[model samples]
Target: MIELNQVSAIQQQTQVFNQVSLKIGYNERVAILGPNGAGKSTLLKLINREIYPVERAGSYLKLFGNETVNLWALRSKIGFVSQDMQEDYTPYTSALDVVTSGFFGSMGTHAHLQPSDDQVALARTLMKQLCMDIDEQRMFQRLSTGQKRRLLLARARVHHPQALILDEPTSGLDMGASLGLLSLMRNFCGEGRAMIITTHHIDEIIPEIDRVILINQGQLIDDGPKNEILTSEKLSDLYQTSLQVSQNDGWYRCWHG
Candidate 1:
């Protein structure tokens, strides 16, 4: 469903992505594991066309086989969810209102934006599926971080996007809230939509995300089955730490002695 060949991202005359190549097939779930400054967020933006890739010979990005296409249409096909999406929302917007706005491709509900009864029903159904019980009247700014995240997921999936791209999904979430978010995503994985997740924490990765790609210093280090790519030495090197990684029943964790 996605392909990037010899892609590089340049910002302020500095390269944040260096000849990176990766492919994600339709309905394939994958996780991108990287440390700080590894350009994970940049990679997501590149896929969504939020930032243009460096235009050069032999470097190209193809979405559904076209190097050039309408970004607005591409956006509807892919649900790009991220921490940055939180900033676009108006502080006083209700959670339901926030979700309904996704249908119109707006950050939040607006004065002229009107949601149909069917769309409102769909949004509420998605909210319940994500186990979000926040009052429809509750201001978005008042909801907890996890609640906001769940509501956003509802917004993204309201249209059954072909793929979901999540960047640092659990960054500021506490243990309980993180688990809740993961659980929601875990269930969504089996519904046949693809997911590309970028995270520093290993445990946030769901087992259904059977493919793992590690990027460091803005380059693709490795890509393969999750079990093969995510290991003690690889992770330790990626993070530049003396760390030990452990896994149980396909769940991974990191520690240091």
Candidate 2:
């Protein structure tokens, strides 16, 4: 449900994307794979409307068939979860409060922002569905990293958005936590929702994600089905290092050749 035509973006005096063109459709599962500092985050920001592509000939961005949309309305259609958002919330905010803040499109609850009863109930229901079993009143900062991530996932889905955009969905977690989170994501996508995830790790490309887009150094490297794009040669070139790729039970992994 996103279209970028020869789009280029600049952030902090650095050109993050150059003539990037791509389309993500509704109910599609795709992964934007790249290394660090590879413009992955910048691309996500552009989709989230947190940044804008530079004006140029034959370059445009469209979300849900429109060039312009209200940010509030957009959030209702696409839920975004990122590590930056996790860090943006106040440390003392309660776990449940963090989830309810999604109604206000905020990082955390403010004194003046009052969520209605139904909104709060939805947030709680989402958390339960995600299998987050922590006390609702616990401080966000006190929760484990996986717990915090799950809370953010709940917050993102509180509005029952049609799509989810996740950046480094499992950045800092042990194997168990990573798998748990990915399983939760797969369940979410099973509900006829689209998911666009940006990740460096090959294992993060869940089996449901059929399309894979590779980006490196602010340029599109490759785009195709996961079976074709995630080969050893392409992944090695994408990371600028020798890598041997293997797949098992619909999961892929890479290691030094």
Error of 2 at 188 (Å): 0.9
Candidate 2, residues 128-245, lDDT tens digits: the string is: 8888856999999999888999999998898889999999999987788899999998898788799999999989999989999999998888998999999999998888899999
RMSD of 1: 1.4
**Local accuracy of candidate 1 as per-residue lDDT tens digits, 1-257:** 88999998987788998788888898999999998888899999889888889888999999988899786678678887898888667888988998998888888777799999999999999988888866888999999888888888888887788888999999788999999888878878878889999999898998889999998889998899999988888888888888888889879988973
Please give the CA lDDT of all the candidate structures.
0.87, 0.92
Off by over 4 Å in 1: none
lDDT for 39 in candidate 2 is 90
Candidate 2 — which residues are off by over 4 angstroms?
Answer: none
- TM-score, each model? 0.95, 0.97
What CA root-mean-square deviation does each model show from the true structure? 1.4, 1.0
Residue pairs of candidate 2 with colliding backbone atoms? 1-24
